[model samples]
Target: MTSRSRPPRLRPLLLTVTLALALAAAGCGTEPAPDRVAGRSSSGDPAPDRAELEARASAAQIVAEHVWVTEAAGYALARQSVGVLGDDGFGSSYTAPDGGMLQLSVERRPHAEADCTDGSAAAGGSEPLWTCERDGEQWYRATESGHAYAREQGELVITVSGAREKVDRATLRSAARAAHRADDHELDQVLPPAGDASGRQPVERGDLPPMGDGAPNNDVGASG
Candidate 1:
């Protein structure tokens, strides 16, 4: 009986601790359902569709002084201009007098080079007789016959789509080359040699020629 009396004081403290824990658990238990419902409602916000993205891409424009070139010589001959448009806009346009004028806009990526490379000269009957090159931030031009005399120069860059499902640079280069081959009447033989989209073609990631000092020597094959 005496020992039972001595244990009585600690029982009150244990009871208080138990009561606090029970209250906290009860407070936390019932609110989860309501919180989850609120979170779900907030998370269900809608996002922009495909059309919106396309529109945004279209609106972005170049705003800088661009160096454009129209080369009319060599294995790679075409007239095209590439320039830095402002801080964001970058575009290139090409024209073949007898054929069509095709223009393409360059997409901007963080810390990327504006690659222009040694393009093959426009073969005989080729619509465009000019070739252009853009590497890093410079653009150059040469005449069709000036290619051998002008030398091969420019950079080839890889352009990947958002999903990486399509390669724009490869597509553009291939189409350009195809146009050249068609003019030369060597389309079937030089191109379409049994290759799928996944297969690598002639235009691998080629390196751009080193930029020499002074103005680009475009005075090849001058009419004296």
Candidate 2:
């Protein structure tokens, strides 16, 4: 009887088939899909609701009012001062009585899909402004040409900036504290329509002059 042996190519093909079968079996034994839906995670945290997001957008008005130059601790609204609320942000500026200048602003955007943690101005080399907490919210402040504080609420990040000699960390934190959710009617009155041409131009951190010994231009303005 002739000795029987598999062809070398046939052996390789058999090995390949075995490997493919093993892989298919492994896949078949994998865990089932998570029992969740509609932007929810396997851990069961649902994405923010549309109405909730709209409410947060309305709350941008609170940041707008509280972070105005006129809202500074020792400043009054100047004649040339301007404060306007756009659909997504607010900006205000004023000249102090002693010739100093103060500009305060706040902007809001929807939370991103990944990483919704509150950012810090210290990341830009400025220092933290306050050391307290309210209703589980911690406020922060940093300096560039001025001072600013930023905080994150459920689905919104609010930042308040005050630029002037007298604008202190405490004042900025207070401004942060004053920010609250505003009602729809209030937001409608303060914020311009989505396509309005006349509104206070958003004052970006870069728009302000750089601080002395500029260490990174303060994260408040740079970070959204």
Candidate 3:
């Protein structure tokens, strides 16, 4: 799909909301300076390995494009979405067309990140990190609120009460678009079309962080 028409793809990774708040509380260095990926070290200071950097780059692109989060509450609850960062950033998440349930896709890249990480690392390393199913791509970092994840994958095939229902792809898109509009209305909320301060752009790769890799205090049930 064209970048403008692309679905919202970056919100699901916001599963790190708790940690982001904690980082902010600890005065974690002023939100990574907009263009910078706010990575921290074991000491809760900014630090990331090559892999982490790439993951942020991927996320930033997702954010720059039509980043959105999809949510629904009902018997037939299912969520799906797509988003693009720029010329090269394209990614999508959806329930499986078949019975497999949740599925995600993106192009290839240099280094990658997963959507979830086991929360056992130090403060800096403990941020909810994303992962790439593939490797060998560019790298960078991102700064976003965990609660803003665009897609709620865990609910792709959800059961409200006693009935099972799939997420409505159309509904998901609607919510995402609303979120973008909300961002637009807020001051100092717009992300630059180009890469963040790190000078990285979005990549066309599907990467998620390893499960349980984020801070133990965080819950990734939504993006899972």
The lDDT for every candidate, in the order shown, is 0.26, 0.38, 0.28
* lDDT string, candidate 3, 40-93, tens digits: 111443332434434443555543223222222221112112334235533322
Residue 148 C-alpha lDDT in model 3 = 24
For all predictions, the C-alpha RMSD in Å is 35.1, 26.6, 19.9
Off by over 4 Å in 1: 1-62, 65-67, 70-87, 110-224
- TM-scores, all candidates, are 0.17, 0.35, 0.20
Query: What order do candidates take by lDDT, descending?
Result: 2, 3, 1
The clash tally of candidate 1 reads: 32
Q: On a 0 to 1 TM-score scale, where does candidate 2 land against the true structure?
A: 0.35
Candidate 3 differs from the real structure by a C-alpha RMSD in angstroms, to one decimal, of 19.9
| Cα lDDT tens digits for candidate 2, 132-222 | 2232354343333444455554444555445435555665565556554433333333333344433233445653556676445444655
lDDT at position 45, candidate 1:
36
| Clash count list over all predictions | 32, 0, 56
| TM-score for predicted model 3 compared with the true structure | 0.20
